[model samples]
Target: MKFGLSLLFIIGFVAIHLLSRRMKFVRMVPRSRFLSIVGGISVAYVFLHLLPELGEYQEHLYGDIGNAFWSFLEHHIYLISMLGLAFFYGLEKIVKHSKRKNSKKTKSSTGIFWLHIGSFTIYNSIIGYLMIREEFSGAWGMFFFFVAMGVHFITNDKGLWEIHKEDYEKYGRWLLAVSIIAGWGIGAISEVNELIISFLVAFISGGIILNVMKEELPEERESSFTAFFIGLFTYSILLLLL
Candidate 1:
């Protein structure tokens, strides 16, 4: 059952990514926004928790929003990505402080944009980390995290594209560099594992984040040590799970 379910999940996504990205599924989503993205993550959280028992394929968190949201996030990130795009579109409507041009043009939203982002990360990260810790099970769950993470990446690609199309136009990519460094640095706030997996998680997380912020911003590379540090840590965790 475990093996079959894993295969089923993989095949299903293959069909969806290839046939459905351009399909009515994408079009039919009603709200198509970020809170909706949060809603998707919530569903994913529940699904993942249920998956292991279904397939006898136990797995834990994939460093997704941490624990609170991790259970299903790897499954739902695509929705989250789409929802994020929708959320931004909606924000364009309700935010009175939004820089609307008197005639047509608008100004770069430097202040509140960061404000929104800051709040989002803090609220999500705490919940997510607890979920990861909560998913403390044996190693069989490795397939659950790795495969889900792979699928999650594709969704991230969607989120990245949508966010770039809509928001980065104003912010300029400088924030990409700053935010990545900040996320990695802060996620590594623990001096305990500062040189270990924790820091790398922070760094790669920073990278995954900046990936969305990319193309619009100048390409920036982390130092070889930092890059390796982050990759090593990520792979290490993957191996641990597997």
Candidate 2:
């Protein structure tokens, strides 16, 4: 039953990447309330759910690692989380720099496009793998994960579309879609050490926070605070109940 449900969720995720371009309402000039709300929900999930889960994973790490240096590091999952945020921030800086350098160009350079797509492909793959392998309380846990991530993908797709334009529609989306399935396939066949999963959970928590914030915080985005609050509080309540 879990396997079947996971397959359904994987399909949902792939659909988000494939069809997000058609979501015209999310591409508004004032930064669609929908997107802002999605940003809020993504942030809420990271803080309320994923971060707490990371703490549990940290406890597991305490028993697993023995080296003094490794022991010290294992306790600081937030450090790994910070690294994830920094990694994506660096990627964003590179993409922005490339855009500024090629001001006359309508789309990001081909190299920059691939760099962006490659990084996100890996990101999507991690999400997919975790869907199968991560410890969830029940089907509801998986459902919430799907909802938060599904909306988060909408925001991500909008950003990529703004940067890469047609290239994203033509190629980048398909790669991401395929990457998720690839990750799920790997998760189904192989179980890695729990230490690695802990690291991944921490890393992804930070990535999600950074990605959502980058979309919402920019001055030109004209993001809707009301909608953001709505999504944040609404999702927070649901998570708490769960």
Candidate 3:
């Protein structure tokens, strides 16, 4: 029960992020993807872990307190990630400090985004394999977390990282911090079966291709029969092994 809910939370999260630009409220999510990732994890815990335990009669009381707790965790994670990001920011300052006026300015591009995707895919495939063991709910939980993190990282493109570029070197690490914590929290609270979890994960992952089409290769990306077959084939391989 816990696992399925957590997986769905992740699916919803990735779905929202991947498809956000098309939605009417795309610009009005009221929070950044960073907050959503953190909030999704924290919120799911409240719903799955604490909500049911509260019983239906006293629902309002528990939910309110749980929400407060969720907020606390979200803020804490944000602060912690900020500190980690700050470290990277400091490092960026150092790197730029040694630069001379003769140094060429670099531009960020889709290649950086692709790097994130590549890393996320390979990493998730491995983690999924490791976590799919028999009689290991904890392992499965971790898998959900990793899947969420992987999807977030792979799908992430917009952010201060891209906006500020050299101005915020810690952006990548901040993203890493957010993705990692959210994934871990979701996994820790997850309680479901392997097949269901995998399917939901695959559903979320399919959105990555969607993201690529919408953001990365909006025009150049093709989706003909051949491309469809390739995508289907690749997804089958991943679902089978992982």
Candidate 4:
């Protein structure tokens, strides 16, 4: 059952990447309320689900590492989470810089396009890996994860489409779609150290928060606060109930 469900999730994630460009409602001029809702759901998951999971991971890390050096960094897991956020934040800055420097260019430069895709490919892979390896209560937990991440991917796809345009359609989406499967395949083949999984969870939590924020917080996006609040509260309630 677990294996089957993991495969189902992999399909769902891949489909999101492959089909998000065709989601015409997502291409609105003032930005879509749906996207804002997506932002809220993603943020809610990071805070409600992933952050608590990070605390568990931190405990595991502390138990395992019991060294003086490790003791110095009491919030090492959180630091990793912050690192993940900062990494994506830096990437977003680079992308904005490129756009400003090439204001007349219709498509992002090849270098920037690849850099963006490459980074997201790794990000997607980590998500895929966690889908299989991360502990959950049962199907419901995984289902919530899938829902949050599925919507999150839509927002990410929209952002990437705006930046990369034709290149994203032609190449970038395909790579990201495959990356999920590739990561799942790795998970299926062999499990890595729990320590590594802990770090991955922390890192991805930060990345998700940053990625969602970058999409919603830009004044030009004209994001919908009401929609964002609805999504956040709805998902938060569901998570709490679970």
CA lDDT scores, all candidates in order: 0.35, 0.91, 0.37, 0.90
Clashes of 4: 0
| Full-model lDDT, candidate 1 | 0.35
Candidate 4, residues 48-96, lDDT tens digits: the string is 9999988887776675666777664446778889999999999999998
- Candidate 4: give the clashing pairs: none
Window of ten residues with lowest summed lDDT in model 3: 49-58
User: Which regions of candidate 2 are displaced past 4 Å?
Assistant: none
For model 4, what is the C-alpha lDDT against the true structure?
0.90
TM-score of each: 0.29, 0.97, 0.28, 0.96
For 71-124, candidate 2 gives per-residue lDDT tens digits of 776779889999999999999999999999999998989999999999999999
Q: What is the RMSD of candidate 1?
A: 16.2
Q: Which numbered prediction scores highest in lDDT against the true structure?
A: 2
Q: TM-score order of candidates, best first? A: 2, 4, 1, 3
Q: Which stretches of candidate 4 lie over 4 Å from their true place?
A: 66-74
Deviation (Å) of 142 in candidate 1: 5.0
Q: Is candidate 3 or candidate 4 better by TM-score?
A: 4
State in Å the error of residue 2, model 2.
Answer: 0.7
Clashing pairs in 3: 2-191, 3-191, 3-192, 145-183
Give per-residue CA lDDT, model 3, range 83-189, as digits (tens). 43343344334333534332454533334433543344333432333232213345454454444344344334343243335433444434443443355354465
